[model samples]
Target: MLYFCPASVRVRAASGAALKPIQSINAHPSNCICIKFDPTGKYFATGSADALVSLWDVEELVCVRCFSRLDWPVRTLSFSHDGKMLASASEDHFIDIAEVETGEKLWEVQCDSPTFTVAWHPKRPLLAYACDDKEGKYDNNREAGTVKLFGLPNDS
Candidate 1:
């Protein structure tokens, strides 16, 4: 199964060689920029230019909750190894982490430039992130491009 989009997202069943579109959804007010599925595939998420991330239940095929901690267009999204924590990155100077089940923001990690990507360790709670300002697109891109690891625990 896949959830993808431009301004809207489509639910597709990717069981065979051909991609058969199952459904189309105007999932976001603005363009949907990125999407990610949790490790279990029971849940998936959509990040948008609206600066919001929408969580969807794979079974019910509906939005279960939303994360709106970012003020800039959401650039990336990733779920923790256990799929209990979700991290969102954007043009903002901070990357926001949210508790998947409760929709509560866990914390934010401050960075020197716009965050471009985030990946959770498959077996650990560590999160790896990258930042860049390619062509000086943002004013905070003083560090060039760097990737860093953060061992942020779910409890803290």
Candidate 2:
């Protein structure tokens, strides 16, 4: 069971047992924007308003890695189906993939529009990301969105 505390505080479980928290590490300057646990439940990643993404160990309860941003705040994060990669989306309108162990960015896709969400395929390596586009300068026309599929190359 993974949890996200906006202020980086460790939360107690519902069993009335207090879990020991490791030294607190601040991942983002602001509250966490989003968080997701890997399918295996071994680790979790956090997206933040400070434009950074952080990976934490579930068992150790300590942050293992942080990916800083240049200008955009990270809004969403997801792990690949196989848990080898991480995908992060931000207000910068781009989605980025990174190596889970090293926090090394592998690739990025620019949406050229505002993005709101990102998720991985349950059984495939494909990613589904959502973005919004305007039809006209004054058209405040916000329509239901779609998840644009982004493909990943074979790891081998």
Candidate 3:
């Protein structure tokens, strides 16, 4: 398992009597806000306030790739169920989806407000995110919060 601290990512053995650190990586220059393991457990991704996302090899404990596109702090990250893509939500009102292997940006969309969270459907090509509407229109309505869903194009 992995633990994401302010500026580090620690790998721990989950089966041990006590979770002991196997390795630790100083992953980000600023606070690391989110970490997620891919579905296959072969790789993990970390998002930081320094406007960067890092992909790491689980066994090698080394960074395989770094994605630097966001101009604001990243708030959340989610990997597709197939583990081939990664999605990041940032405080700058944008969300980006990228190909995991090549760090190629698949697409990006701007939201009306800063996004707080993002998730990909476990069995489909649908992406969802929630935003914090500072305007208070959605919040005051007491309706469902500012949540949006997007359907991705077929890979073929």
Q: Please name the candidate that would achieve the greatest lDDT relative to the true structure.
A: 1
Total backbone clashes of candidate 2, pairs 3 or more residues apart or in separate chains: 0
Task: Show model 3 residue runs off by greater than 4 Å.
Answer: 7-15, 134-144, 152-156
Across 63-97, the per-residue lDDT of candidate 2 in tens digits comes to: 88887742577778889998988988776867788
Alpha-carbon deviation at 143 in model 3, angstroms:
8.6
Candidate 3 lDDT over residue span 1-156, tens digit each = 667556244333343567666656788767888889999889999888888989999888899999998988888999998999999988776788899999999988778788889999998778898988757556555545777787757422
Looking at candidate 3, what is the lDDT of residue 62?
91
- Shift in Å, residue 153, candidate 1: 8.8
lDDT of 1 by residue, 101-149 (tens): 9999887888877898999999998889998855444545465566778
Total clashes in model 3, counting residue pairs 3 or more apart in sequence or in different chains: 0
Quote the positional error of residue 43 for candidate 1 in Å.
0.6
Clashing pairs in 3: none
| Residue 5 in model 3: lDDT | 58
Cα displacement (Å) at residue 11, model 3: 5.8
Colliding pairs, model 2:
none
By summed lDDT, which 10 consecutive residues of candidate 3 come out lowest? 7-16
Highest-scoring model, TM-score:
3
> CA lDDT of 22 in candidate 3?
64
